[model samples]
Target chain A: MGIIKLCGMAGLIITGWLVGFKKSADLRFRVQRLKKLYEETEELLHRLQYEGLERDRLLLSSFSDFCLVWNGKILFNESGLTAEDAVILKEMIQKLGTGNLETEEKRLLYVLERLRQQESAAQKIAVTNGKIYQTLGTCAGIMICIFLL
Target chain B: MKEDALDAVLPFVHQSIGRVFLFLPEETKREVCELRLRRNLPVCLTLPQGIRYLFKDGTIDDRPREGVLICTAEQLEETFFLLCKRSVYAHAEELREGYLSLPNGCRAGVCGRVAPDGMVRDITSLNLRIARAVEGCADSVVSAEDGGGILIAGPPSSGKTTVLRDTVRQLSKNKRVVVIDSRGEISGGTERPLSLGVNTDVLLIRNKAKGTEMALRTMFPQTIALDETGTAEELKGVEESFHAGVQIVTTAHIGEKRELLERKITRHLLASGAISTVALLSGKIGEPPEIFSPEEL
Candidate 1:
């Protein structure tokens, strides 16, 4: 009976940790993806102006590794992202693809800065939430196990 | 005309619009010169002669067809944004010049309010001019003029660029040709399948005057070609090209030889004996070639 109860408790704790870790992993991926997008955009803009690469090819290739947006359709890397962030990110990318070079550069800098702030803030929230959810999950499992006993 | 060249713009449009557009009769596609988009207005296809409204269902309403589904603000925005590749910021040079040059060498002219800092905003209309590189039509020009700096004059859409493009190709057979393409229309780009001939070097710059100087100093070619040499600065560039011992083959937006001497700009270029021979294209574009070359006045 005691062995069975211990097995049940272990299962609960493992399930809880897995769920919490998955959530935090998604948050980290999103932040990394956003940062990659920012760096790629800056590099791509330079290639466009100095190298005269075609815009469509540059945009499509810049994010091919991330697979974030394809042919105007947004493909989010992490399932955890909200619909709103995806939409906003698409808009920023679209804006980057059009306009005069100077204005575009300025606009992209603004977007990169905005993305940076979001990344930082998201990182903080992710860290906090990850800690909270993980602890809450483990504690709940222990409480449930005690109750069963 | 390259069929796939149309693909550069197909992705941004509504499926209905593209389907209907692609379904256009071959004759319609052949003659289509411009596509106009106005917010709250029906999208239109401009032929050389008349305007036809394009319907979503792949049917065109000839001029008399009154009621049609007009373009929405959202559709216009999407199309414009797509044409700019979702970034109007990169085309700042074109935006300030009031047009965007697509990859296929087509030009989209945009109209909108200018922000305080000169940024274009609230674009309400986009006019796309489909430019193609047609080769054989200019063969007659090369055969017509023996080696000399030639100038072509005609009214708007008079195939001036067409003549220039073909003439450049023909001239490029043996001569090293450098084209100062202020707009992408002349040769599209060095990479485009649209051949300006292998011996040709193209400088796709925005300012014709500056481009002329750049070509003269660096390209080191036997001939320098450009389109629409109208401005005073452009005329100066013409003299510079002539003085450099490089033949300047270019076009002007004018009708007759007399008008060439009458217009202050053309007159200066001609009076200086800068333009050796002038080929005037009279017949409508796409019609059999009828060039009237009046000896330099």
Candidate 2:
């Protein structure tokens, strides 16, 4: 009976650990997607400035996995962005093709700066909170198991 | 082309305004020459007969005070952005040129504050000119194998471009025809390429002069057709093509036959011997054009 109970407790602890790890992984993946978005936006700016490619050509050619472009607008999917981050990104994209080269370059530079800061902040959160969540889940499970005993 | 002419421009307006277009009667839609949107004013459609204000219910009014559909400032701004295809930077050249040559050969004339760099800002109004392909419209004035050049003359909105489009389409059937469609009005756009002809080669360069020169050198076209040949530079290109023995078919804006000599470009155009036949369109849309030799003017 004791062995069976211990095995059940072990399973609970493992489940808790997996749940915590998944959350942390999601946060990490969000950061990676943000980085990708930043790179794609930079490429877009470069093409607009030098190549003068049209909107249809540019949107059709965008290869980002995080963005879904339809009917001349970009929709972010599973972007792991905060409300504020998403709003900022959207504002920049809404005006993406609506300015001259110099204006667009300036606008993109400002957005890139903001994205870099967000990425940095997200990295810091993932480092600190990720470990905390995993430890908390394991500690909570162990305490419950001890109490049951 | 008439059935879808207005439909082609619907995507470029705000959703509310575009929806109104959807409910518009088919007969009215077919005759709509221009769709005008102004800030804080009733949306208007310029038909063949006269300008009519549009309402939200898809009905139109001859009076502005009626419960007409109003084009708000925000709507105009959004419409302008859409017309630019959400990429103002990409359309900077066209915006600077004061118009946008849209898909399906539709054209939008933009009016707004001018930035020093020539880009328009804070757009206040837009005139969306619907493009229609009137097949056989040019049949009366032109033949595919006609020897010398033909120049179409008309007032604004007098179907000069329409006739020229058909002329090119007709000529391309038998001749090695190249259209210097700098504005994309003649051959429509890439999204839905207008049927110029199976043999027509369309060059979308903005500079008619450069486009003509390049077409002459590389395309080896038997006939080169262009629109809005209003400048000496374009005339020079037409003259060059003439010297190469490549026929030049083009258009010019002239209110009357006498004005052909009054305008310096038209005078040079007629005297250059580059153009032999001139087709003068009545200000009316579908009326047959008056064909004349250069001597008649």
Candidate 3:
């Protein structure tokens, strides 16, 4: 019975830590994806600068595809963003669609910097709090085991 | 091309506008020369026949005020943004001229407030002048025997650039032609070169005078072409190139050779034997371009 209780405790603690780490990894992936999208926009602007705007709209439409893919179900509400994060993301996309490259670049750099900060924060929370959660889960299981005994 | 003509602005405007444009009978899209938009005004299309308003039901009216939808600020902003590729800084130099030459050979003439510093600060209206390239329009000019050079004369929107472009393409088949594209209108866009025949080079330079000198000095082109030459500087450049034994083809905003002769620099150019032929063109909508030589005049 003691062995059974120990195994249960180990499972709960490990699951808690793994879940936390997975959430952080997901956030990091979103940040990387967003940064790549930003680079695509930068290249579009660079082309627009030297080559000129095409009337067929091929370039802008291509960018729209990226936007659609980004907003697709896979990314929807999965970045673990808080309310503040959602607002920022919405504002950034709105500005990106506006077509002002200089402003877009500045805002993108700021966004990237912010995302990096958020990623670090998420990672810190994932690692530090994950350990805390694991420890708490183990303690709870131990206490329950004691009670059972 | 007609189907995707408004690609740059499609993302920003409502679907209603796109539907109206897309639903435009294929015949009408080909006939229309411009898509005019103004703040708080109905979208007006400049057809070969005349100016008309577009309705949401895919019908057009000559009334001009019967628009079902208005041109919104968002649409205009997006158009401007996309036109400049969202890089306002890089386009600042060209924006001061009150017009943007897009890649599809369309010219968007903008009207708006001007800052004291001379940059076009705010835009109120945009007239997208659509270009229709009639492939064989320059046949007469190309087949002419004169090796001296040809000057094309026409009023504004009289398709001078179209004729010049075709002429260059045809002449470039054999001659080493160099087109000094002051505006992207001639070559379509810098990145995507239009098919300017087999042996031709296009130099994208906004200043006509500077472009002429640049072409003469470096290109060693058998023929040099410039568009809309009325200034003294352009005349001098053309004269110098002509004297250097490089044939010059160019255009001017004039109704006839008499008007061109009345001009100070052109009179001198003609007298000096630099310009051999003055080809006057008057092309009506849906009609073949009628070219008249000096003898016809």
Candidate 4:
């Protein structure tokens, strides 16, 4: 009975650790997603500046790995984006092909700058909050085990 | 061909507008020549008979009435972007020229404020011109014996491009033809382009002079065909090709023969001895064009 109890305690602690690790990983994943989005946006700007590809072809070629779904206006399935980030992206897309070269480049640069800020903020949170969540999850499991013992 | 035109244009409009058009009666859809969308104005369809206002339910009337579909600024903007395939920067040249050439030979005439940088901004309206191909339309124009240049003249919407397309298609079958499709209208577009012929080469260059030069140097074309050649630069290109002994088939936006002298380009074109036959089309669509020799003008 004691062995089974110890095993249960160990199992609970591991499940807690796994949950905390998943949360920490999610924060890191969000940051990675933002970085990927930034790289994609940079490529998009380059194509717009030099390639002059049409909208549909441009998106198809540029965002093949972006996991995006464009329905004429809004872009859906933009994973790992916050509501604020989504709004910003939506605005960028709305004005995507509506301006001249200079204007378009300026707009994209502006959006990229904003996204960079968002990414930096996300990175900071991932560093601080990520560790906090993991520590809290592990401590909670230990406290429960101690109370049971 | 009417169905083809609709197919070309319908995809570039707003979803709501496209839905309305899809439900339109076949007869109404067939007669459509141009789809006009103006900011805050009732949607208008230019039919062969006359202009007609569109209702929300896909019905049409001579005058704007209640429930008539109003083309909001958003719709106009969306249509503009869609027509440009969502990349205005890619079509910057065409946008500056106040038009966008769509697939299937259709064209969107854009009206907008011009920025100091020569870019069009604050778009207010879009005129979507439907492209239709009438087979054998150029049969009378393309003569087997005549190896000389031919010039087609007509007013807007008088089927000048249609006839020119047929001329290119028919000529290309027998001879090495190059189409200086500056606007992408002649050969539909670079992607999913319309059939010109087996021996046809398309140059999507905006500058006719440059296109003609490149064609002469590389393509070794027997004939060079272009549409809506009015600019002095285009005239210069034609002159060069004429001197090179390459036949030219092109079109001008002149309604009547009298306008030929009024326009400096037409005057120079007629006197240059480059164009042999001038086919004048009446304002009516599908009417037989009146053909005359350059001397007859």
Whole-model lDDT values for every prediction: 0.74, 0.85, 0.68, 0.85
Let me know the DockQ for model 2.
Answer: 0.71
What is the Cα-based TM-score of model 4?
Answer: 0.90
TM-score of each: 0.80, 0.91, 0.76, 0.90
The deviation in Å at residue A1 for candidate 1 is 8.9
| CA shift of B209, model 1, Å | 2.9
Q: Which stretches of candidate 4 lie over 4 Å from their true place?
A: A70-75, A78-87, B57-59, B65-67
Top candidate by TM-score: 2
For model 3, residues A1-149, the per-residue Cα lDDT tens digits are 87886787677656655665565566555555555445655555555445544412424543453434332111223244555555655565555434333554577678666656665666666666656665665566556556655
By summed lDDT, the worst window of 10 consecutive residues in model 3 chain B runs over B4-13
Return the lDDT, model 4, position A140: 77
Q: Please give, for every candidate in the order listed, the TM-score of chain B alone compared with the true chain B.
A: 0.90, 0.97, 0.90, 0.95
Indicate the docking level reached by candidate 3: incorrect
Candidate 3 on B1-297: residue-level lDDT in tens? 544444433433345566677677878877777788787688888876787888877788887554465778777665666566554545656767888777657777878887665556567888887765678888877777378778777778878888888888998887999998877788777654566788889888888889989988998999998887778888888889988998888887776557766877656666666667676776464444444444444
Candidate 1 lDDT tens digits, B1-297: 647455555665555456667666777776777778888888888776778888755567775355554777888888877776665556666777788776666778889897665666798998887777777887766776756678888887778887888889988899999988876888775445367888999888888999989888887988999998889999998898888788889888887657877899878877665676777777375664555444536
Off by over 4 Å in 1: A1-67, A79-91, A94-149, B1-15, B55-62, B67-69, B114-120, B286-296
RMSD, every candidate, angstroms: 4.1, 2.6, 5.3, 2.6
True contacts kept of each: 0.72, 0.88, 0.12, 0.91
Off by over 4 Å in 2: A5-20, A51-60, A71-74, B143-146
* Superposition error at B258 for model 2 (Å): 1.3
lDDT of 2 by residue, A1-149 (tens): 97999898998788778877888887787788778877877787777677877665665565355466776666666467778777876787666777788988999899889889888988998898888888887877787777877
What tens digits encode model 4's per-residue C-alpha lDDT throughout A22-83? 89888898899888878888998899778888766677777665545466544455677778
How many pairs of residues in model 4 come into backbone collision?
A: 1
